[model samples]
Target: MKTDVEKASVAMRELFAATPLQLNEHLSAKYGAQIYLKREDLTPVRSYKIRGAFNFFRKVIASGGSGKTFVCASAGNHAQGFAFVCKHFSVPGVVFMPVTTPQQKIDKTRMFGGEFITIRLIGDIFDQCYAAARDYVEANDGYMVPPFDHADIIEGQATVAAEIAEQLPEGVVPDLVVLPVGGGGLSAGVTGYFRDVLDERAFVFAEPCGAPSLKTSIATGEIVTLPKVDNFVDGAAVARIGDLNFAALKHFAADQVLLLPENAICQTMIEMLNVEGVVLEPAGALSIATLDQLDPQALRDKTVVCVVSGGNFDFERLPDVKERAMRYAGLKKYFILRLPQRPGALRDFLNLLGPDDDIARFEYLKKSARNFGSILIGIETRDRSSFPELLARFEAAGLGFEDITENEILANLII
Candidate 1:
């Protein structure tokens, strides 16, 4: 009998060609290791989610469960994948997404599914939308196709690992595999598959720092739900790991998972876009961002594979991504400056700026003050070191200012 992963792999070929496993020379050179990327971003729906969705639908049909309509709740890649599969199989599907989901994703899902699927926008967050979807599924006698948390989904996602195993040169096994963990479907599938096939291999999992569900769960030895999660890395900003997925991943140590800051992930996305012309969504860049956290000596001379999970990035978010990257790199800053109400006050402040410093934004917050006016200023510089020099000049000139670059509340309000 064929293993479930093998069967899923075979079944996947009917839907689309296997995503490429290509050696990335740039990453290899940077880390002094042979770096390979399992490019799940190249899938028909631009993510590995399709593998699980297809498998779920396939099994449902094969078991004479096709009479029921398939339902799912997602605002990201999973929705697109499920829609694509629905169209492919001519099965009816209902997708419930949060009202705040990007219009690009909504349009893409509609385009992929066409007449086979109906999209419902409800609620403000995933949890609320998910509850609505479940209610619909229960009331309508429909099948709830979970984005993760199911055995069939895990088995389907394992097809990615199956392809990796076959695509590598004969007898060549990767020394390390890095996976991005959201609700843990891809990580569970890939890790579980490797444990059975490879005798010795190291695994590193990456999760967004804002949503460290998997990392926190592994640390506490139990499933812990986060009260709040930042949705910047929308694809992998899961507040909790799936129950079945956690069970599969529980054997791994807490140290094996890396929590990546959202801004740093944006840096990785920008790097890939500028250097390799690869457009990766924030979650897709997680595995690559974790590379910076690895000890270079440990990874040196090792064969490493990083899963590029998805490329469904909206170009509309590019500006935000770039802004975050700049802030994370310390190349941009915002401040509130107290300037004297004098004719030469603005000129004196401008003189304090270094040669490489450029004022990106300057606005007078209030002009009512008799002695001094408050000014909101944003600065961009060629080097991070320029900030200290500029600040020193401000101190020497007796200028008063407060740096608000790292102050979330202030930055959000003013910058």
Candidate 2:
């Protein structure tokens, strides 16, 4: 029997040409490595998800399954990919998205599938929507094409690695390959192909710290569900690794996976946008952020390829992106201050600010006494070091304040 990787590559040709493997000079210079980006972000649905969707449907058809109706649960790029594939195969599909999904994403899914698909806004979270889709597919005798987990999906995703291998220059294999992990289909696929075809290339996986499903799974030797996940990086915010994907990835060392903080990812996104003119979604920046964890000297003369997974970023979130980047860089901060109820006290604190310091947010909480009150102050500076001088002035002047910049509870509720 032909291996799963071979089958995926065969199915991909029916959909479209391969995604580009272009050299990115800006990233190469920054990391001091000859870097190339596998531009999966440029896929038809703006994500590699379409590959798996197409493979699943094609396999179903090839197996002589008469089922023309397919169902899937997704709130993001996966839904778009499934919808597009459903249209491509001229098959009917039903997409179940969480009711909380943004209107923009819902509309995009509709546009991609057009008359070939029906959308159902079912539950508050993806888990509920997935359960609902499974129930519907079972009852209606429609095929339930999973966003990830199936053998075919893994196979389809592996085609990315196949293309990378074909696109590289003669006798050139990257020293390291980086991938962003969501449900693990893409990572498993690429890693499988790399190990099977080019055993010498090193592999690294990146997952959002808030949703470190793959890293956690590899560490515990079992797929573990996180109690909570930050959905800021919604594209790859999976709670657990896919069963099929974990099986493929089980052989890898635990240290090969990198967990990146969500805030730090924002910095990568902004840098890519401003420096390279790349508009990557939060999850798309995972692999890029992983580069920071690598030793520059170690990769100085090495060849590296990082998958820029998806660029389906909604520009409206740019303000939040900027805020997160600033917070992560330590150039901005929020503090709860105990201020004396005196006119000269405010003036003294103002004078303490460095030349580059600027007040971003200032609000009075409440007066505790005739001489003291609580204040919420947000400050920004050109450089992160400016905070030290600002804090020193607060100490020397005897001003009481609490830095709430990293306080998740207060930041979530207030900022």
Candidate 3:
């Protein structure tokens, strides 16, 4: 019998063409290493999740499991993928998503599934929403299509690796393969396929800093759930790695995984859009973002492949992405200023700014004190060093100012 992954690879061609593996000259020159991006972002559902979803649906129908209703819980890419497959197969599906999910994703999922899928907005978090989906499956005798846990899903995702094997030039093997880990299906599938066919190939796993489930699990030699996950990288901010996926990835050393800060990931997204004209969602940029953490000397002249996971980014979040990127690069900051209640106070502060410095935000918090007022100021500058120079001027002028850029609570409230 043929391997499941081999069968899935043949089956996927019916849905869409294989995504490209393009060499990136810009990144290659910058890193002094050859870099190729596996553009899973260009999939029919704008994500690799569709591969697994389609395979799951196909296997179920082939095994005489047709006519069963399908159910899943997802706030982003997975839902869209599932919806697309549901419509393709002419099967009914129900997707449970958190109420807090962005309307853009919900609309996209709806568009994909059309009349074939029903979307239920339930609960405020994924856990609660997932529980509701599970209940529905049990109550209605529906088939639950899990995001990343099932063997069929893993086999389908491995098709990506199978394509890579065929697409690359004959007799060429990458020195390093980088994958972004959320629930770990993609990483596990790709790594398993490679480990079976190749010898001495290296793998790097990237995870959101806010949800380091894969890194933590690899370190502990078991699965570990994060107490809280920052959903900024919503596409890959899974709190826990799937059990089967963890078992597949457990042998890798902890050092092989890189935990990427949300802000840094934002910077990578911005860089790719601006420099390469590539649109990537936060999770899609994870592998590329981790490249900065690699040792330049070690990676020099090496062949590397970075999986560009998805492009399901909502344009509505562009401003937030830019803000986070600016803050991470230290080119923008917020300050709480205590200004003397005098006529020349504003003029004096204005003179302190450099030629390249621009005021992006200015607001008075309160004027209750007769002698002073609290002001919130946001400044953007040409470079990170400009901030230190501005702060020095503040010190020399005896101005009372507190850098609130790093204060998450206050920044969220005012900036």
Q: Relative to the true structure, how large is the alpha-carbon lDDT of every model?
A: 0.92, 0.88, 0.92
Error of 3 at 385 (Å): 1.5
User: For model 2, what is the error of residue 100's alpha carbon versus the real structure, in angstroms, after optimal superposition?
Assistant: 0.8
**Backbone clashes in model 3, listed as residue pairs:** none
Off by over 4 Å in 1: 197-201
Model 3 residue-pair collision total: 0
lDDT by residue (tens digit), candidate 1, 123-221: 998889999999999999999999999999999999999999999989888988999999999988988888866543389999998999999999999
Instruction: Sort the predicted structures by lDDT, highest score first.
Output: 1, 3, 2
**Candidate 2 per-residue lDDT over residues 308-335, each given as its tens digit:** 8898899999999999999999999999
The lowest-lDDT stretch of 10 consecutive residues in candidate 2 is 192-201
Estimated TM-score per prediction? 0.97, 0.96, 0.97
TM-score of 2: 0.96
In model 2, residue pairs whose N, Cα or C atoms come closer than 3 Å (at least 3 residues apart or on different chains), thus clashing, are: none
RMSD of each: 1.5, 1.6, 1.5
Report the number of backbone clashes for model 2: 0
